[model samples]
Target: MHELAITQSIVEAVTQRLPDAQVTRVCLVIGKLSGVSVPSVEFCFGPTTEGTALAGAELQVEQTGGRVRCRHCGDEFPCDDLLAVCACGSVELEVIAGQELLIRSVEVRNHV
Candidate 1:
C-alpha cells in the first residue's frame, strides 16, 4: 500500500532529524481530499516500522475540514459534503483545503 511508503518516508525523516532518538509518536494532519486513508495508514505503520526505531510508536491522524471558495461569489465555506458549490448557488469554485498531506510533528525520546 502507499501508506507503507508514506510511513517509510516518515521514519526516514524522523531518523534523519534525531539519529539517536527513539520515535514515540507521529502526528499527521490528513485532509479528507488527501486521498490517504487513516485506517490504511495505521494498518501499514506497524509493518513499515517493524525493524525501525519507530516500532511500537503511535500514529495519530488529525482530520481537518475541507473548504472551497466560490469563484463567482468569492465566498468561502465548508466543502466536506459538497462538490465545488457555493452557498450563493454558484458552481464555479476552487478547493482551498481537504487536500493536505504532511507530517505535523514527531515525538521522540533522546537516547542518553
Candidate 2:
C-alpha cells in the first residue's frame, strides 16, 4: 500500500533531521478527511522503519477535525466530505483541515 511508502518517507525525513540521534517516537497529526487511514499507516510503520534509525520507535498519531470555509457566508464549519459545500448554499469552499499529513514532532535520544 502507499502507506508503506509514506511511512518510509517519514522515517527517512526523521533520520535526515537527526543523523546522530535515535528516534524514540514520532508524532503525526492526521486529519480525519486527509484520505489517510490510521490503521493502514500504523500497519506500515513497523515494516517501513525496519533497519532505519527509527526502527523501534513509537508511532503516535493525533486525529484532528476537518473544517471548511464558506465563500459566501465567510463562515467556517466542520466538513467530512472532501468536496464539502458551505452551509450558505455556496459550492465554493476552502478546505481548512482534514487534509493534512504532517509530522508534528519527533522525539529522539542523544547519540552517546
Candidate 3:
C-alpha cells in the first residue's frame, strides 16, 4: 500500500526535525474527500517507525468533512460526497474546505 511509503516519509521527516527527540504523538488531519485510507496509514505506522524517533508514538487522525461553495447560489455548505451540487442545481462549485492532507502537529517529550 502507498501508506507504507507515506508513513515512512512521515517518520523520516519527524526524525529529521527532532533528531534525537522521542516523538510522543503525531496528529494528522485528513479530509473526507481526499480518498486516503486512515486505517491503512495506521497499519503502516508501526512498521515504518520501527527504531525511529517516532517509534511507539501515538497516531492521531482527525477526519474533516467535505465542504463546497455553490458558484451559482453563492452558498457554502457541507458536502459529504463527490457529486456535489448547489441548491440552485448548478454543478459549478468551489471547494471551501476539506480536500486537505496535512500533519497538524507532532508532540515530543521534554528532556529534563
lDDT of 2 at 26: 99
Best by TM-score: 3
Worst 10 residues of 1 by lDDT: 78-87
lDDT of 1 by residue, 18-50 (tens): 777788999989888777778988888888888
The lDDT of each candidate is: 0.82, 0.87, 0.88
Where does model 2 exceed 4 Å of error? none
For candidate 3, the lDDT comes to 0.88
Using Cα atoms with residue i matched to residue i, what is each candidate's TM-score against the true structure? 0.85, 0.85, 0.87
Candidate 2, residues 1-112: lDDT per residue as tens digits?
7777888888888988888788899999989888888899999999888888898999999988899888788999998787766666898888887888999999988656
Query: For candidate 3, lDDT tens digit of each residue in 1-112?
Result: 7777777888888898889899999999988888778899999998888888888999999999989988888898899787877888999988777888889999999999
Error of 2 at 66 (Å): 0.7
Off by over 4 Å in 1: 110-112
* Higher-scoring candidate on lDDT, 1 or 2: 2
